[model samples]
Target: MKPFKACSCRDPETKKLLGKQCPNISKKGHGGWYARYEAPKSADGKRRQPRIGPFDTERECKAELARVLGTAAQPKAHDERKTTFGEYLERRYAWRRSEAETGEGLKKSTLDAEREAIDLYGKPGLGHIKVVDLTDEHFRELYAAMRKLNRPDEKDDRSEILRRLKEARATRDGRRLHSRPISEGRIRRVHAVLHGALTDAVKLSKIRPDNPTDGVWRSKGGKRKQGRAKPLLWTSERVEAWEKTGTVPAKVMVWTSEQTGAFLDFAEATEERLYPAFHLDAYYGPRRGELVGAEEKDLSLERKRLHILQAQSDDELDDTKTEAGYRQIPLDDESVRVLRAWHKQKLRERLQWGETYRDAGRVFCYEDGSALKAEYLSSRFRILLDRYANIRAKAAEGWPADRIARKFRTTEAAVAAALQRPLPPIRFHDLRHGAATMLLAAGVPIKFVSEILGHASVAFTMDVYAVVADEMAEDATRRIAAFIPRQNRLSAVGASTVPSGG
Candidate 1:
């Protein structure tokens, strides 16, 4: 293709064409110079002319003409159907949803998370860019934008702050309200969604063969350096601090052994219907979802084993988080007893409700037999812990009988008796961590802990519970030293110097 030419309008008064012959054009100065080019035909084979600019000089117009011609000469293969990144993401999500419905793709929870990431980060940051035009620089810009969103500056806009405050008041319960920065883990999840979408685009030939995200730097050099915070054990010091400040360290907080026992005891005493579920979680480290998803048919009371074939997400039972999460977990005698008691309790409820009872076959359920919502259980667990804390505080202060009784909704005698003990508060999922730590501390093999926890691999288990493992290693060192008798060591050294039997 030849470079397009530039021309300028004539002087209005003179009414003469200001072509190359104009005296002003020789001086390289002109007014209203415009570049015109014969543009490429449309896909429908219609001819068209495209104009670029109204530069004051012929040289400037010519440069613009050259750039436009160059761009037109190398048309994008998929330019016929230009798709924005946002549009592609929507299409990709629909395809994924279709595959999930057909049992060929992501789990509902996984898909929901991806959709959230796309809407919150992907669409807002890089959505307008064409998939074929996405570059490493664009991804870098996207990451920078995401980091800004992660820890957005306190909203300076009064209207926005008022809106958020209104929302807070609407949802406010006794729970404290605070803004939390989007964690590194959440940013990584968003990146994963973007990477997955780009990968799919490449496979479908919607974009270039290479995925731009493949080479993009993660928010903090990948999740290994800035991933989810590890679960923190509720040691005595942490418990004391928490009791004083009411601030729990790390979201995933594990209870100490004493606290775990105290929670189990309190749950049982309070007639919590899901005590058995909590019991299993504390002893076996099954996820909250797995505990809620437990079915009576999958339990072998005689064998003391529970099959973790699935997990509860929202109100629906679905496949376990991974294939490895489908393994069987052995139950202790106490766990078996608790489950047996819960089973008998369930049967009696079923009998009482009779025809009205909804038999979902879940090992844990409401008295009416409907499936338990995972969110309800989590919230209820927190509420129960709060109640337990209040009761303990009242008892500690030596409150009079009637006040304690009225506060706890129990007899004064019961309140007085319960005052002798107190339990530290912890999140429900922390029960799983407590179980893993207890097992590891008690000299259970890491492999067994891994299998019991349904972790994908022992390495993952080790990584998560490395603190406990280090403690166990120190204990082992001391025990080994104790086992090697001083006399025996001395005898061996003397024997070595004395020479062989020959």
Candidate 2:
């Protein structure tokens, strides 16, 4: 029998073979083995090539054609200079992220609004304009479109596609509407990010002349400014609640922070049996990578010290966050106990996994005998929080469910949000303050507290946790308790005697 073969099909129109049309192919082989595609041209005659692939059989030809019909597509290379402003913004936006992981050029998150502005206004208004020809007016149109993320009328999802078809959109951060019709504050963050990217691009001379984001502060109506960032420092009530419940996922984090003694100052913590790993972070603030990177071999048991011997990311091993992240942290007897436990747990896991595991010489591992990603743990922490709070605080705090669904990797969004929770009216770091208060009440010297908390100077230690309102209230009660006058003092010409300071 002959090898299987199929004949070509032809279009009824003028009997031209359907396969030979220049719908977009750059070149087609005479032997029927290959086809090269050029970009499609807009009405203005500027063309861009987006899709290119090689098929082993004709069965794939129709499938490739179907993919091109559906919406949501990237601009072809040929349309590089003629695509919408939104196209440029999206491309640059992705570029920055890819660069950041590699430790390459300027990296940031300010492209969100720039991207939205382009999607919302810039591309419609001036995307067709040559990249070399962008100007202040184009920026204004882009800004105008971005304003919609905040505004309701501008938010009509139905007109989303139509509204984006302008050659007059612009983006700006202050009170001005990005594209008018936009009216909300929740989206200001995206705008802020976008503007930052445009500004940096301007500095790099990637885009010509001035940046459209110049002078733009993330704001709405030049007034309703974006909220300030605040750290989500755990509080005593919250901590005590966790200790009592002992079921919250964040409990480990809180316990770990307190137990680390790297930062905790509660006198009871000095009981000498508990590990105080928290002090290490309180003093050093090791990024998750640096902290999780610690391993058994990195410790000197006799000296009671932990060293940052190795660190890594999905990409490759790196020195700590900076040269300074590489340091030897002295441990106390208590801290040693905790670390030793964690070390034993890890060693057991490694041995169980044996040669089947992806080895990274890490100190932190999962109960499953595998390396635990820091991000995954963060997610678990949130879950444990939700369950512990009976789902009350989670909803009240407005965490993203979709986000929490994934494991904790140290994403900027998670980190920023984790750091953005509101602080108490007094010292926001009251957990630290409470710890210090406990330490001071037990007569731990200010100098020792300073060393444990990792403050380079003693004055800082004294200034922060020494003046608690509750402590003052206690002192008031003690001072008001006065005894009967001293008989000897009366003989000395005093009817009543009190301490000189009193």
Off by over 4 Å in 2: 1-207, 224-285, 295-297, 308-324, 386-502
- Local error of candidate 1 at residue 130 (angstroms): 4.2
lDDT of 1 at 164: 32
CA shift of 54, model 2, Å: 42
Model 1 residue 180 CA deviation (Å) reads 3.9
Q: Candidate 2 on 300-376: residue-level lDDT in tens?
A: 76898778755655334455544444567677676667667666766676688778756655555554544555565
Model 1: C-alpha RMSD to truth?
7.6
TM-score of each: 0.73, 0.45
- Residues 189-300 of candidate 1: C-alpha lDDT, one tens digit per residue: 8788999888877666434556888867654654546454577766656667876897877877766665677777767766667877777888888998887788889999
Instruction: Give candidate 1 regions above 4 Å deviation.
Output: 1-81, 124-152, 157-179, 208-224, 244-251, 410-422, 469-502
Number of the top candidate by TM-score? 1
Q: Model-by-model lDDT, in order?
A: 0.72, 0.46
